[model samples]
Target chain A: MSNNISLWLRYKAKLVVTNVSWGLLTFSSRYRAGMLLLFLGLTLALFQSGNPRFLSYRMVSTILAQCAEVGLMSLGMSIAWMLNGIDLSVNDLANLSALIVAMFLRSIFRPTNETVLLICSLAIALTIGLAGGALNGLLIGYLNIPPILTTLGTMSLFRGISMGLTEGKTISRLPSALAVFGRTTVLAIPTPFVILLLSCLFMYYLFSFTTYGFKTKMTGLNPKAAFFAGVHTKRAVFTGYIFSGLLASLAGIIIIGRTLSVAYEYGTQTYIIFALLVLNLAGIKPGSYDVLALLVAVVLLQTLATGFYSKFLTLQGGPFFNLFLWGLVLVVVLALSRAMERWVSTRS
Target chain B: MKLTRLLRHEVVLCLFCVFVVLSIGSINPAFFSLATIFEVIRGAIPYMLMGLGVMPVMLTGEIDISFVAIAASASLATHNVLIRHLRYQGGLAGYLLIGLPMGAFLGAIVGAVSVFSGLPLFPVSLGFWLMLYGFNLFFISPEMRFDLPPGLTGFYRRFLVTVKDPVVGETGLHLAIVYVLVVGALLAIILRYSTFGRGLYISGGNKDVAIRSGYKLGKLLIVAMTLNGGLAAFAGILQCAFKRFFDPILFRGAELFVIAACVVGGVAIGGGRGSVPGVLAGVFFVQLITRGLVYLGIKPVWHQFVLGSILLGFIVFITTRQKLWVIFGRRKR
Candidate 1:
């Protein structure tokens, strides 16, 4: 038993050393600069607000809850972008999955059997997501439609189907059981935040330790070369889109759970922008640490949002103000990061 | 044989448009009425203008998805200036002057940014799109609606020509139709016969070759985007005149539809291989599909699904056909 304990300790030491070096290598100067800016912005926001509520536990939970869906979608988007493709249909897919599940739950099951309804709805939502993603993969990988155009077409198609299914209405009266995943607190953290954290951990492992992840990176860097080097480029691209679709579905479930209703237009305007913002904040680099950077970006954005709302509670056109600030932040960060990258390259 | 030679994608599109119209007419004769025809033509004007505007940019192997936002902003600018009765006495000319220049300037800024940043036009335009959308939402009240000035309204509503029909009463061709024809003809001349047009084709076909041939790529991109922005603004102004109102949500998601029309018209998204006529036909085709659905009594909710399917179908057909051609060419060689 002592020998086994010693072996475990040695293994843990090796893991720590490897993880540290990997973090150091991936956390380039650009990422450091981004993190600095993030913290600085947070500090400014906190100072300007001068409200103790800024750092309150409830506020922290709200920010985390608010960012959960966007954070999840951003991870999927980063993967798709790393494959040199993008999934514009992600927002629509999320809406569609939620709508499908909601419609199923409302139409087929009795309210008494809440647990069964939840399980079946989730299972069906995941199936739809897989099918939708696989279709995108087939079109992009096998048929060679440009990713943007394909996603654009699919976005419209998905939204249209959702609209037709729901008849331009919202599906509400979802089972109360979904609230456990969407709205409840788990160990003092919001349930959605927990789900996001779990997803990030899984993503880190998948992208860091898996051969498929290596192949995906290879394909993104150079598809022809990767193919020549025996990487199945098409398969990698296919799986990347499928993974994005699955994550989007998960996000949809969380959204439906939180709101207790599903609408065709839900997340239509915000998810794509938020995902792109997170990707941009991470400098569009593909790596395990990008997941962490995404979480930080989400936190920073959510704080800014909540702070703006609190400070200007009486302001007219609150939505407009928030949107303007989001846009401003996105542009500044993107421009700054681009400048930093150029500066770093010159110095090197 | 000569007729067959001339019957390419544009001709095919024309034929398709005719087929759709006739089919709809068969189902509901009211669809063939002169008023319906004019309505379809008027409805297609904005999309056609956008398609024409984006064609050159797409020809130069770049894209500007911010055109819709630019249009919305331009319209708002015109509305604001005209409503405030700002310093300009030319009425319609004054509004056009304000709107068009603002759009051109924005387009130039987008072009310069894309060139300087070394980023693809997609993300840069997307950023601008978000910014402009936010700006529009912030400044423009959702309730703000404006009627055109009396002089401009008269001119906008003036009939260039009138056609009499006993079945559907009298229908007059509006000045908007004239504007579309004039702009379309002008763009056709510029695209097909001008040296700049040839430059666009060359640059889009092969950037390195164009550079080797002494073309200034950055300048060309700026020019293309500027022209695109100007036309988009014009479309917005016309839309305001036609609808006689300004809504912040007007023309939302129009950029994608305009791009779709261009693509369906056989304008290669990769650039260098399309025509003004093809784009016009594409605009008509898309309008016809939507209008025909209404005529056929199909639920309007299916409109988007059908349009998307058509777009995907065309893309698949074109790509597979190209691949097959390459394969066959290799075999022959």
Candidate 2:
């Protein structure tokens, strides 16, 4: 038995470990970022191959807009994930924020003073989002409720409030001023895309350069340990949730500006799953994630979604087939990442 | 000792059930009838089965959101193959035979992947959840399939026990409730009497102890997941049969909903504790609130809010009881 075991280990268990491919594929952040970009380019090319229109400047603009919505969501999701928690209510909170702002704007019945209306809308959306996040933080951090359960309850709660306020009616025909985020582009860049870029940068700075961020990471990694280390873990957690809420609310504002409407049913739950997929695709871990990778993932997903909506695979179930492909992509990404990690470990 | 045991999670849920029933009954005195009880049971059949199906996986201390995916794909596949493809005119037996194994097979695939990949259960299951649903949409018909084979046409109206209601005239308990009873009793028995069941608890509660106790930890985990997947699929198929149609998006956002229901039933989220009774009471409680709202004339918008608030309050109460006792009771550790 010992001889057989030794023989099997020697031959059957042999792994073809090499650092050459590993170096380019995943050795450093720079290489990994490049790899992700190359992969993104490849996906774009493949979809373009199916339809020439898919690669057009018009398509890129649409992709950027879609990317902003998903990008902001993933960023919000990333914050919760960083704290070793999840924010299932982000999309719901976004919708609710937008709804509140819409209700405010609609009650005024105003088309006058566009600047003031936009500012008030922005303030309402952000404040509502912050309050919602505070509620989540109180439950999860101060009260010691599990993040998932708390968020799950809040997910429905926020949407319920939105629905109750609206009586399940969509608020449309908003003041053109409220649609500033969706309408205006700075230097040929969509305003939503600009918002996404600024948010990403701000979040990156927060995570990388702040003591609070460090504390948050430690708290998420091991709450007891962080607490014992005098990290004020509850505060870190509370703050983290607050930030996620803010991010989600921003996404809501973008949606309102872009669509010029708000409703309880907006964003839907698919946005939650898609945001999660972006996190997964970006290879996020607690306390550590690549913001650029997140952006790339959002763009990639948007392209895929657009392609499907445009019937890229018309021969094979058309638009509906996109879901299957998304699922497949999730599985394949997991497998490939695992393989990469395994290869790295076998190097020793 | 019995009284002390009764003070646990399930008992609290039972009390909550009474509270809900009394409040809802006050709002609509008509809700105090046996017909409504039978109706609630009929509506909760799928929910109960799903609760029962998911319990083992949770007991093993691992979350499996993929079970819904398992259900969607398996039921869709069964319908497509048996009804759409073969045009079989057989009864529920043909559907079950095809679906149960197919569900089990899909579950086994989940098990095999989780065991092989050695990733965290949540993410693996999450991946499968998306994969299976997408697969169902991509490969199976994306549209809702209302065309039930001749055998299933009568299945929707089929009931085990009929009742005479004063107002509605005729009402009956659904036949699918049998699945819940059979599954619940069987699961209850298995969880209590079997070594495999004990192994799940042992492993979930403590991996090192489980390893030392002669349990095949890897194999046991896989089996638990498979059972969960298979049961979820079964629940889905039953629900589809009863609804008389199949949709690709059936239970799309229900992952959290189902898990929240199961966890509320006193199943320890970290594993090692749960009961069939607890699960049943949990589902009954949630389903009552869901169905009872329509009768209360409170408008559909407020229903979700009320449910969320009540659910939140319940969890808060559960998590804070010890603290509350410390505050109000004799304050000593």
Number of clashing pairs per prediction, in order: 0, 1
In model 1 chain B, which range of ten residues has the least summed lDDT?
B84-93
Quality of model 2 by C-alpha lDDT: 0.81
Per-residue lDDT for A1-348 in model 1, tens only? 999999999999999997775554356554654664667476656645697556677777888898889888888888889988788898899899998888777777655676776778789888888988998999998887878888888888898899888888888887788887688999899999998999999988888788988888888888988999999888988998998999889889899889999999997856787788778766666433456777777777666666777766777876776666666666666666676666667645
Candidate 2 wrong stretches, greater than 4 Å: A1-17, A28-30, A44-56, A108-111, A307-317, A346-348, B1-3, B157-160, B214-217, B325-333
Interface RMSD score of each model: 1.6, 2.5
The estimated TM-scores of all candidates read 0.91, 0.91
Two-chain DockQ for each candidate model: 0.43, 0.49
* Per-residue lDDT of candidate 2, residues A210-305 (tens digit): 898788888888889999999999899898899999999999999999999888898675687788778877777776768888888788778777
The segments of candidate 1 whose C-alpha lies over 4 angstroms from its true place after superposition are A1-41, A44-49, A110-112, A286-289, B1-7, B87-91, B164-170, B326-333
